[model samples]
Target: MKTDKPRVAIQGIRASFHEEAAFRYFGENIETIECNSFKQTFEALKNKEADYVVMAIENSIAGSILPNYSLMMGYSYPVVGEVYVPIQLHLMALPGVRFDDVKYVTSHPIAIRQCIDFFDEYPHLKIVESNDTAACAKRIRDEQLTDTVAIANTLAAQLYGLDVLERRIESNKLNFTRFLILTTHENNKKKGPANKASLCFQVNNEVGALAKVLNVFCHENVNMSKIQSMPVLGKRNEYNFYVDIEWEEAKQFDNSIRQILKYTHNFNILGEYQQYIEDDSPKPQTKPDNTKRYITVKKIE
Candidate 1:
């Protein structure tokens, strides 16, 4: 139950994974607040209702939590840190709830997709969407509803005192959730091994505009970890790029960022921090499929 004693607003209830990630980052007893939407989380931070907001920006199975990406840009907040929690999705329920007795499965979209194998097996069971995977777990715990279950992490079960009837229900084994720690208070303090930086920018609608913008990094031999595009409102054929860079914050880090800034009309450097979980996990034997480029970007719709 250790904590930094800061009021934290997360997107869901106590048992939600956002709370879990927040606890991992800030420790327990964070003077928690719950926000119904990502916007509300930022609002809480702005209005000083909460000192920070912890949220998921991407997943191993789902790419670019698009709304969150835009939200980060819309808000005047800074990404202070990050965490990658291993998503050990579980089929959890109330006591005496047998696997055979379940008729409805509730969770977030990514949770439902991760446990596709289980849903496929229980063809008669309906997959219901909830605001969050752990929120569903918390709901189940509060109501003690029969014949209903949730897919969430072990943290949720531990928080709500629910029985994990089945563990590791994700269709894939290498499930992981990447979380972002956001604060408006200029929290420059970060734990060691910080290597990545998230940035966003919009370029003038011109031929080869993006290429020119990206060349800034290529010239510096800085690696581009990820790049995603979102359309600009009322502007067809124009989009903004959200970029994640494997940045090396040496004496030259700031200079490199400055050079990139000259080429773009609008830009934002969200955060420069270490990969919390990946830095701690065992080195992968091979390049994982989770990092592979996809033809169609899957996002929260």
Candidate 2:
């Protein structure tokens, strides 16, 4: 009954950004299990229904998805790798529908916010919030809504046979989302060498207590890429610190972790995985007019 292809769980329907990220990380041959929410995505992995899970952790324009951080803590899934996907929002509708025919625009709240600048020009078009961007596009196609447009990626438009009314409608063209590739702890141990690590811990609520922990990383020559603090529920003034660090040598990071453990309480190492670096090169144009550049979806599998 076992197959060679990996079954990846993602927090959205087909053609959603999460699915795009999953395909980018696991390859097109992998089967995707769509979950309605990030919590459900983690559950699929925990229940052994999925080989891996692709979850979005942060976005360049909208900042970190804090809820996902809490979910990671509760689930304790090991992050084995990461991928960065460029977010390019496009307005699409039925084939014959023109720009003026769009009476309402729908998409995920985050996607709607990112394209505010473009929508500002059309005050008559009502903005509607949807559960998922691709879902909005799918709705328009299934219901044959000629007057409704959806803001989503080109993949959604292509898959649903919707014509793009407007291209790259996002306020910022440089917007990108970072997704973490997570797996079971047993599978995580078999991964290759990792240069990056994610950690969580709680420090005593005292002056300079958090700074002291950071100093230990500096002394060990470990580069702290990110640090986030979330208030501990039901506890006053206590916070859980989530940190990501990168190092060139294994011993340096190991020593840093040991020294940091001495000053923190409930220290947890979320995962250690290879860091993703975005490629800086000229991408081929997907259109004849060269109006839109293809969003590079890198493959690690």
Best by lDDT: 2
TM-scores of the candidates are 0.84, 0.91
Error of 1 at 226 (Å): 1.2
lDDT on C-alpha atoms for all candidate structures: 0.76, 0.86
lDDT tens digits by residue: candidate 1, 1-301: 3245787888876667787788778766457777777888888778667777888988888876888887888886888788777777888899888888889899988788878877787799988998787778878878888889988877777767779898888888887778898887465567776677888888888788888867877877778878889998798987888888776655445666888777786777888777564446453332112321111111223
- Per residue, candidate 2 scores C-alpha lDDT tens digits across 249-276 of 9999999988988899999999989888
Query: Which residue segments of model 2 deviate by more than 4 Å?
Result: 189-191, 279-301
lDDT of 2 at 246: 98
